[model samples]
Target: MALTTKGNLGPGRTEQSAFDAVHSAKRKDLWFAAGGLFVLAIAMSLLFTLIGDLIIRGTQYIDYDFMTSYPSRLPERAGILSAWVGSLLVMLVTAFLAVPVGIAAGLYLEEYARKGWFSDFIEINVSNLAGVPSIIYGLLALGMFVYGMGLGQTILVAGMTLALLILPIVIVSTREAVRSIPQIVKEGAYGIGADQWQVMWNYIIPAARPGIMTGAIVGLSRAIGETAPLITIGALTFIAFLPSPPVTGEFPFISFAWLHDGFTVLPIQMFNWVSRPQPEFHIAAAATGVVLIALTFSLNGIAIWIRYRLRKQHRN
Candidate 1:
């Protein structure tokens, strides 16, 4: 009996030591979780404080005139009509140029491009471009489009610049989404006599749409809020007149002239207001910030909804 008890004591001590190690690990995990939560709380608190302040100071200014009237010398009379319109036009141009091209490049790289040095080189460059600063894209656009091509400080220039800035993001997202698709799925498509093009178009694209769209919207949200690139391209700070619509009452009813016109976007307009010495203009800047935030958050919300819907559908 004494020999048996002594032998059992060694095993008991081993068990206790193992249990203590697990408990210590769990405690460490809890501490890490607590630290993460504390950091997240601090960040969220700051964001809410900013939003609350903007609402308190800017809500009264968000009326019809504020939406319709152009910027003015007087703070009370100023509105974001020209700014919003320019932003809208620029975004339209950006979407038109970026979406199709980015998706196409990504698809080609993932599906069709030969796994060679050239393909590797392209992939490396794209990944690098995704990390490049927005201001660099603006400088590139300034030199290439503005000075070289002589596009001038136009809506098209700003839109194309932003489109280029966000291209790599879309491409990378596309590759990741497409890469997630099972090879067996494509093999099944091939077994049914489907070509590469058909398989990609009918199967891969639909499967990857959710990720592609999420990235696109997020990229576009970033583009819309960007100021450095536009400012670098010498976007107008103050503008009162609206661009001519694509149609005009003349022989050439359809025109592309509006793309060439000088423009001021929301961020640029808000920056202009914020730079002034007047207290009223500061309030106006806050009001403009509210509008900008609304636009950005709306896009983000749409992206989130799309992602949620896709996940639910996939689960179903």
Candidate 2:
């Protein structure tokens, strides 16, 4: 290579030469960027390949009937109607029980709990619980809720089991979100004569909403896919009947009977199909998998949209 001095180039060309020289000096960074791109490309390739295979194999079996019909022994006629509805009901109960309690626990731990040995012990356990296998939660729910409390293997039991499974995740997410709020923001609120409750409700919660929502969505997604815990709770895989609605034709007909009814969820249903020896059921399982993935992604998208809207409103 020929060496060139600044004087060798004209005024306009001199800065361009220096810029090129600086970039050329970092040959290692260029190689690193190329290597990172290659790895990402490989990962994306595997993902797309799996998705493509699933769609190709399952698309023929997907139809409106598949979404509305109950499971049948015949793969050609089988549908996930009972499975999807049961999953929805169970998740409703899970969210209802988990979100409020999780958020409250998080709030108390982060804001009100005294810094002491007991507090530290609770925090450590919460972190540890977040990593515990989902199956263990099932066994605990079985021992405590089913046989111990006599709730039996019902939709309510399944939902409560999942609630316990995801509670730590929600609490952790909530605390992290609250912790991110600038101390000055709280100080400013207090400076303006705001009380603790008002400061948290009006300022901290709103600011932390995005992170809290992200965590909740992730936790719910995990709960939705969980199979072992529900199985441990004795969720029947062959359920054909829908839980009775909370209300009927009569006046003041609301009821909680449905919560106590037997149920089956998407994961359990898919497991049943996959366990079958027939190849056709495999296709059905793939179709069910697609639907499950779509449901999860839809929830995540909704959460993201809500976060975006809230942040936009906050900026305004």
Candidate 3:
């Protein structure tokens, strides 16, 4: 009986210790969760505060005239027509240049490239490039596109610069999206004697489309707001004129001359306004900032809607 009592006490003590450890772990998890919420609240508060301030300062300045007229020396007459139009044209170029190339490169790396040191090296470099400073890309564009290629400080050069800046982002996103597709999906395609291209085209791409679009949205969002690369490549800050109209009334009915025209984007325009000492100019800058933010949100909203549609279709 004495020996049995000692054994029972030993098991009870072990159970008690286990219970204590679990309780302590739960306490730690609760503390960590609370800490995370506190941090998130602080971050959200700051973002809302900044956005609120911008809206309050710029609300009075935003109107139809502000959207239609050009930037002027007088703050009351100043507008963002040229700036917003330039931003639109530049983004058009960026999306055209980046999307296909990034998606193709990602497909090659993930599906076709041989597993080797060279491929690994390429992967590492691609990942690293996503984190590279925007200014470096600007400098690169200054040297390569502006000087070497003689594209001049035009919309084309700015587009190419931003394309390069966001290429890694799109590629990474594509690859990740592709990876997220179930392996069995590809296997099923292969087991049915479908070739690589067919499997990729009919199966993988459709399933991965939503993620790829999301990545493009993120990359373009970053590209649209980038000032360093565009400024470094000599984007104008105070342009008062729009790029030549992209469409022509002539026989071709399309024109490419606008691609070569000098441009000013919203960020640079806002920078120009904000640098002035006048209070009115500052208000104009706030308005410009508001427009820029609205444009970005609009783009994101469109992309998100498209992505949602794609996901719904895929699920169906």
Candidate 4:
């Protein structure tokens, strides 16, 4: 059916048109992808611009006096001092509580625990726990530590609560990282007469370093930003004195009282300033926000760098 003089409905025409249609569609798809990227870039630029504005407008208020000044009884005079110290103290406590417990739990589940219904149930519950509102965990801490256990609402209790709040995230991340290791590494260690613990610490885990570090950073970052649970557990909104960074009894850092004491965090303090009637307080809040954001970025950066180094080490 080569076209008669009219060239109507020729097989060659059909083939040529179909090829042209497909080619045109592919070109359109490429353009669509490029357009999507352009939009995404614009959105990201807007976000950066907003952040820059916050820093510029806010940093005008940030100074050495701001860093060292304690919270004032008056909203107008208050600085982020107490909140900064409390956040530092409480976060250290949360880190101490969360890292070991989470890593251990992850290890037990991934490396040692037998595959069974109990394990499945625990896994399901942990996932569920991660999704639980952080405020609920704070309430749990309030009930158990402050009221039930008779510990005052202090930094220690608040830290413990936040620890539990973020524990599931840490555990899940750790487990995934550990699970990513090649089974062959474990087997190789076993063939060399190594014990389970030995293989885990020496071979399998090291092989999965990047995943584990990434997960740890993710979890830790989440813990750092938590406000709800710490609020519930009674992290102090303002402390008159800075707690020492470590426990030596000479300068007390640990919150011994849990029941009546209050605690504070960067976010909570930020909230306080932001809510105040004074524009000056809002300026202080923005400054504190910059510090908080910087802390989070620094931690993430360190973890990522560590992961990269470990990966390179393994490759070499």
Candidate 5:
């Protein structure tokens, strides 16, 4: 390990010395690069620990009956049934309205529209809209759907607002997906005398299916977690009547009013219970949070599985 006049030269270098230098250098560099990951792991652990503690403390209130019944003032009486139904309705409706519109707008921007002021304006505004506060979207829903349009604070309005709120994200993701398709595919479709619309519908969109599905699912997850807009629309945190169907007096099926109705959602209901002076309410909120987390995770899992299957099919 001594330096000569110019440099240290060994008669023969040990394999272990050579290995240590090579390995140690790489290990040090690797850890340096991965230092951020360690920090991320620590942060995630703290978060999950807090969530886990809350869930464990709250699991008492997370009964199947609680999931299937309406909210009640009595700690022993409350359930998430109405909120759960409303959330499902809102989510389904939002997906129906937003997915197609977002994908179309994305396709237009990336594949059809000429680059210019209008396109640029839309692009810039959309990017900005993605960053706009969720509460701002709530205000918009309150003003436009509830008041201006006279929808009267129903599930429909909340769904529409959430659809718009996450539309930009969907559009951005869809456009990126569309853009990733090789131009050669479009050219080949054209070479076969396919019209532009035909090419897009038959080839281009299918090619981008995985990415589009991923984006739409991400947007759906965001919409599912929304509480502010529903709250702004005046969600009834303790509604009875099980939120019966907007249309039906037959077959014994319960439903909701799409217009002029006060509804509840999991978050808003959880918040209401949580704000109670009882420690039980905190446990309820934690339990509700776990339900929401599970729902979100399931949505993500379904989307990812679909994408993987599609990718596998393409590979085959």
Candidate 6:
């Protein structure tokens, strides 16, 4: 009886210890989750407060005339016509130059490049580039595009600078998206006798399109708000005229002359207005901020919609 009681005591104590350990672990997890939630709530609250304030201050100035007219010295007559138009043109150029090249570079690195020290080196540099300051890119562009190549401070130069800025982001996102696809999918393609290029074109790219688009749009969102790089490249702040129309009634029906035109984007224009001591200019700056925010939100919405549609299509 004595021996049996001692054996039972050991088992009972072991069970109690394990039970206590589990509860302790759960308590730790709960505390961690609570901390994370607190941080997130604080961040979201601040963001909403700032956005609400901007909307309140800017709502009065967002009229049709404000949209159509050009920037002027008088705050009452100043508008964002040239600013928005230039922004659109520069974005068009950035997308055209960056999208294809970034995707191609990502594909080559992931699908074709031999896994070696050189490839590893390239990968590390690419990742590092994504975190480099925007100002550094501005300096690089100033030296390379503005001086070395003699592109001047034009729409083309601005576009190329932004394109370079976003290339690393797009490449990283593409590689990650491609990597997420199940290995079984690639095996199946191989089983069906599809070659590498065929598999990439027909299966891989389609599956990764959603992620690729999301990354590209996110990068563009960052680029659109950039002020330092464009300023470094000598973007004008008070342009009253529009670039020559991109579409024409001539033989070619398209014109590239606008690429060489001087430009001013929304952020720069906003900065110009905000720098003044007058209260009226401050109001105009608030209005410009509202427009910029709306444009950014629109881009983000498009990205989300694209991602959702692609995911649904893949499931179907």
Give the 10-residue window scoring lowest on summed lDDT in candidate 4. Answer: 252-261
Q: Which lDDT value does model 3 have at 266?
A: 92
What lDDT does each candidate get?
Answer: 0.92, 0.91, 0.93, 0.79, 0.83, 0.93
Clashing pairs in 3: none
Of candidate 2, the 10-residue stretch with the lowest lDDT total is: 5-14
| Two-way lDDT contest, 2 vs 4, winner | 2
lDDT of 6 at 126: 93
Candidate 5 residue-wise lDDT, 75-193, digit = tens: 67677888888788788778988999999999999879999999999999998998998889888888888889888767778778889888998999998898899989889999999
- List where candidate 5 sits over 4 angstroms from the true fold: 1-28, 246-260
Per-residue accuracy of model 4 over 233-298 as CA lDDT, tens digit each: 666666666654344455455644432346577888887778888887888888888888888899
Candidate scoring better on TM-score of 2 and 4: 2
Model 6 per-residue lDDT tens digits across residues 1-316: 3456443234355687887787799999999999999999999999999999889989898899888889999889999999999999999999999889999999899999999999999999999999999888989999999999999999999999999999999999999889898999989988899999999999999999999999899889988999999999899999999999999998799999999999999999999999999898888889999999999999999999999999999888
Model 2, residue 70: displacement in angstroms?
Answer: 1.1
TM per candidate comes to 0.92, 0.91, 0.94, 0.84, 0.86, 0.94
- Candidate 2: where are CA atoms >4 Å away? 1-25
Off by over 4 Å in 1: 1-14, 249-254, 310-316
Clashes of each: 0, 0, 0, 12, 3, 0
Q: Candidate 1 has which clashing residue pairs, if any? A: none
**Per-model RMSD to reference:** 4.3, 4.1, 4.6, 5.5, 5.3, 4.6
Candidate 1 per-residue lDDT, tens place, 42-155, comes to 999999999999989987888999999999999889999999999999998998898889999999999999999999999999999999999999999999999999999999
**Number of the candidate with higher lDDT, 4 or 6:** 6
Q: Give the Å shift of residue 262 in candidate 2.
A: 0.6
* Cα lDDT for residue 34, candidate 5: 100
Question: Which regions of candidate 4 fall more than 4 Å away from where they truly are?
Answer: 1-25, 73-77, 244-262
